[model samples]
Target: MAMEKTKETHPHTLGECTKSILPVRDALEVLSGKWKLPIIISLMFGNKRFSQIAKEVPGITDKMLSKELRELESNDLVKRTVYDSIPVVVEYSLTEYGHSLEIVIKTLRDWGVAHRKRMMVAE
Candidate 1:
């Protein structure tokens, strides 16, 4: 004799739902704020100096860019390197851990495109 299998269950309690969403909350905590995502996208292209990142992300101030970059670096999502030269050069790039966000970013980009198209059609 064998035990009969029942259908799987979904979270039915508030605590269960909260527990299920903890990972998403944690990810958002690290990536939150207006500048973090765009900064990350800017860095995905390649290593770039501070000025380059500011230029790439429109409407961002030098101070804000510097602040956001520091936050990203502290979170292990971005790496900053300084080069030895006549003009001291510093560059920013994503870490291997940061590269893990590629798929998430791409998915958000795809959804955004589709959502914009849908909104245009509706309007």
Candidate 2:
């Protein structure tokens, strides 16, 4: 049976609610946790070495950074590159797909700034 498309005035179906939420849950899963967004923000400026990312996102341990980088790379959001040189060089950069988060990040930043000001005024 074809599911009826409800207008905004109509009550939503269980399937409608689940469909809406599932994608957001998946996005949050990929972007979740304390260090992931911070790492992404650091890489947004430019590519960096692992140590550089660790420095930029203060308080994240080397282990956590390494783990987070691996996850991001696995998700195809971050690219890891290696160079054949005197000493091996590894760099991390956001993939073009990752760069797609630019607007989302900016919107979050704006909301954060506004929320901070709102909270201050409320206090």
Candidate 3:
């Protein structure tokens, strides 16, 4: 048995290291979860109730949905409103900051669809 070592071909330049790392760090902070994207996509159309959002996004447990929504709300990307009535209604909508993410999300979705199609054809 022989051991093989791989060499690092792409070395990071000072500018490349800074520019490449910052966006990824920021993106991870904002979009770091299984349910984050789905939650954002659900709220894209408009405000939605907790139940409505959960229903619209399939396969998410009630607890997980609640948690992700709270996280987004805390990050200022999502707004939470509660209407005081006989039955309290809590609605979730995107803040201006969240709305700004629409383009990014759409781009990612488009890329994913194209990638999937290419993979299918290759198979």
Candidate 4:
């Protein structure tokens, strides 16, 4: 299936475009998970082993990490590579489609920092 281009430079932001798609339903479907975004963000840096990803993202259990990785792979957002050697190794990396989310993640992070500062100043 052809991936839809969600990015627009016009009057509306991607969130707005997403809203126009299905509003509550589609948004929830895309963002529904505790660890999806975190996992995606972690893989943005580059390919990483399962253990490395677990270390980079705190508070995620091995089972949950594996599950999340599988889901991401199924969604085509992440690619899994296996290496053959004395000790086999596997790594996960974001696909080109996943790289498109980098800007959105960075924007969200920036907004979060600004929001926290504002809240702290208000207190």
* Model 4 bad stretches (over 4 Å): 1-27
* lDDT of each residue in 1-123, candidate 3, tens digit only: 566565434565446667888998899888987899999999998899999998999899999998998899899999999999869989899999999989999999999999999999999
Best of the two (1, 4) by lDDT: 1
In order, the Cα lDDT scores of the candidates are: 0.91, 0.92, 0.90, 0.85
Candidate 2 — worst ten consecutive residues by lDDT sum? Answer: 6-15
Kindly indicate the candidate among 1 and 4 with the higher TM-score: 1
- Over 1-123, each residue of candidate 2 has an lDDT whose tens digit, in order, gives 777676565455556877889998999999999989889999999999988998899899999999999999999999999987868889999999999989989999999999999999998
Error of 1 at 36 (Å): 0.7
- Report residue 122 deviation for candidate 3 (angstroms): 2.9
Candidate numbers, best lDDT first, in rank order: 2, 1, 3, 4
Collision count of model 2:
0
Model 1 per-residue lDDT tens digits across residues 1-123: 677574345355446767878999999999988999999999899989999998999899999999999999999999999998879999899999999999999999999999999999999
Q: Residue 62, candidate 2: how far off, in angstroms?
A: 0.7
Q: Which residue pairs overlap in candidate 4's backbone?
A: none
Measured over all alpha carbons after superposition, the RMSD of each candidate to the real structure, in angstroms, is: 6.3, 5.7, 5.5, 10.9
Per lDDT, the best of the predicted structures is 2
> Judged by TM-score, which candidate is best?
1
